[model samples]
Target: MEFADRVILVTGASSGLGRHAARALALAGATVVLLGRHEKRLDGVYDDILAAGGAQPVIMPFDLAEADDPRFNALAATLAHQLGRLDGILHSAAQFIKLSKLEHQRLKHWEAAFATNLMAPFALTRACLPLLEGAEDAAVLFSAEEHGLNPGPYWGGFGLSQAALIALAELFAAEHQDNPNLRFNVLIPGPVSSPMRHRTHPGEVPENLPKPESLLPFYLTWLGPQSRGRSGEVIRPDLGYDPSRQD
Candidate 1:
C-alpha cells in the first residue's frame, strides 16, 4: 500500500467526490478521517471501506459552515493525539444551494458558501499546519470547479467562493514553496456524474457524464507520493485524460 503509513483527512467524505476518494485512499492504505455533516452517511462510507478490507476510517460528523478557530484547533489537537501525524488533506467539502440569479440569492447563501467552500479549508488547514509540516511529506488538495475559473451568471456565490478557494490554494503553495515537506493544489472535477451535478443540471442525462470514480486516479496522484514538489496548480482532469475510456 502506497499510503500504508499515511493519515489523510477527507472533508465531505459522506458523499460525492469526497466519499469516493476517501474509499480509494483507504483501500490504498491511508488511515482516512471521514468528515461530513451526517454521522449516518459517514458511517456508510466507513463501513464500505472496512468491508472492502481498506484501512479503518474515522468518522467525524462536523458542520463545515459552523467551524471556527477553536473547533479547528481542537480538531488538530485530537488528530495529533490519536493519529499523531497528518500526511494529506482532501478538501472536497462544498456548499452549493442552487443556481440562481445574483439578485435572487440570499445573504445566508453567500455566508454558507464562503464558510464551507473557502473559510473551512483556510481555518482547518491553518490549524493542522503544524501536523502537516511535521510529516516527512504532505499534500493538501482543494476541490475546485471549472466555472470558478471562468464565471458566468446564475452560478452566484458558489462560483465566487470556488474561485477564491483556488486563490487560497495558490497562496498556501506560494507561502510554502520553500518547504520541502508540504504541497498544495486545486482539482476541478468537470462534468462528473455526482449528486451536485444532478441537482444543478437535472435535465442532463447522468449517463452522459463521466462517473465520479473516473476522477480517483487524478486525486490519488496528487495525494500520493507521485506529486511531490508540485503545488499551486489548478488541475482539470478532463483536459488531458480521455473520457471515452470510461465508456
Candidate 2:
C-alpha cells in the first residue's frame, strides 16, 4: 500500500495506457478515479480493481472531447464531496488525431484536437487546481510526446496540440513551482504499443514496442512522492534517455 490514503485521477481510463495506469496505481493502494467516455468499460476496470483487492475505484464517465466548463465545475464539486482533496492528476487521456498536412486539415479536425489533446487538460487542470491546493503534497502530470525537438509537417492536429500541451506544462510549472505543496511536469511515454500508437503508425508490428504495463514504473515514480523535488522536467520513460549516459 504505497499510496494507501492518496487519491489520484486518471482520465481516458477505459483502455490503452490510461487503463494500465489506473490498475497500476490502484494496486499500489491509491484511490484511483477512472474517467472516460465509455461507462461500461470504465465500470469493468473499476470492478476488476475491486476484485483484485485494491481500493474500490471511482468511475467518472466523461468524454474529453465534449468537456465544458460546467462539466469541470460539477466534477470538482463531486470530487470535493467524495474525496475532499486530490493528491494527483494524470492527463493521460488523449485523442490521437492522425497524420495530415496542415493545408489538407479540416477545421473540425483541428477543433477536435484542441478539445481532446489540449483544452480537456487545460479545463480539468484549472477546475482541479483548487482541490489540488487542498492537498498536503500533490502532482500534476501531463502525458506528452516528443515535440518541438523533432517538428514535422504530417503530425498536423495532434502534433500542434501536443506542442501547445508541452508549453502548457511549463506555463503551469512556472506559475506553481513557488508553492511548496504542488509540482507540475510533462511525462513523455515515448513509443509504446497502444491503440493511439497504432493509429499514428499503422504499419508497425505491435510487438516491437513496449507494452503499456512496462511504462507503469516510470508513471509510479512521477505520481508518487518519490519525485517530489522535481518539477518542469520532461521525463522520458526510455532508460536510454538518461542524461548521465549522454556522451
Candidate 3:
C-alpha cells in the first residue's frame, strides 16, 4: 500500500500504458480516479481494480477534446472539495488514429489530437495546480514518444501531438522546479502490445512484443513517493530497467 491514503488521477485509464499505471497505483492503495471517454470501458477497468483487491477507483467519463476549461476546473475543484488535495496525476490519454502524411491528414483529426493530447493536459494540469501543490509530495507525469525517433509521413497527427506534449512537459518542468513538492516528468512506453500498438503495426507479431503489464515497476516507482525529487526526467522503462526482470 505504498500510495495508501493518497489520491491519484489517471487519464486514458481504459487501456494501454494508462491502464497499467492506474492499476499499479491502485494496487498500491491509492484512491485512483479514472478519466476516460467511455464509461463502460472505464467501469471495466474499475472492476479489474476491485477484483485485484486494489483500492476502488472512481471513474470520470470525459471527452477532453470537447470538454471546456471549466469542465476540467470543476473536476479538480470537486476533488479539492471532497479529497482535500490531489497527490498525483498522469496525463496518459492519447489519440493514435491514422498516421497519414501531413498533406493527407484530416484537419479534424489533427485538431482533436492536439486538443486531447496537448491542450487538455495543459488545462487539467493548470486547473489542478493549486491542489497538487498542497500535497506533501505531488507528481504530474505526461506521456511522450521515444526521443530521437523521427516520425515519418505516416506518423502525422500522432507524431505532432507527441512532440507537442513533450514540449509542454519541458515547459511545465522549467516553470515548476523551484516549487518544493511538485515533480513533472514525461514517460515513453515503447512498443507495448496494446490495442493502439495493434492499430499502428498490424503486421507485426504480437507475441514478440512486451505486454503492457510489464511496465509495472517503473509505473510504481514513478507514481509513488519514491519519485518525489524526479522532475523533468524523460523516463523509459525500456531504457532504465528491463521490464522482463525489474530490479
TM-score: model 2 vs. ground truth? 0.94
When 2 and 3 are scored with lDDT, the better candidate is 2
Task: Give residue 15's lDDT in candidate 3 (0 to 100).
Answer: 87
Off by over 4 Å in 3: 147-149, 239-247
Number of clashing pairs, model 1? 0
- Candidates in order, TM-scores: namely 0.96, 0.94, 0.93
Q: Which pairs of residues collide in model 3?
A: 99-154
Best candidate according to lDDT: 1
In candidate 3, position 6 carries an lDDT of 92
lDDT against the true structure, per candidate, is 0.91, 0.86, 0.84
Which stretches of model 1 miss by more than 4 angstroms? 239-247
Residue 177 error for model 1, in Å?
Answer: 0.5
Per-residue CA lDDT of candidate 3, range 1-247, in tens?
8899999999999988898889889989999999999999999999999998899898889898887888989999889887787998988888775766677878888888889888999999999999998899998988777621355567887787888788888899899999868999887878787888888777677666788778778777777788888788888676333335422
Models sorted by TM-score, best on top: 1, 2, 3
Off by over 4 Å in 2: 239-247
Score residue 208 of candidate 3 by CA lDDT.
Answer: 69
Give the CA lDDT, 0 to 100, for residue 212 in model 3. 78
Cα-lDDT of candidate 2: 0.86
Q: How would you encode candidate 1's per-residue C-alpha lDDT over 98-118 as one tens digit per residue?
A: 998998999999999999999
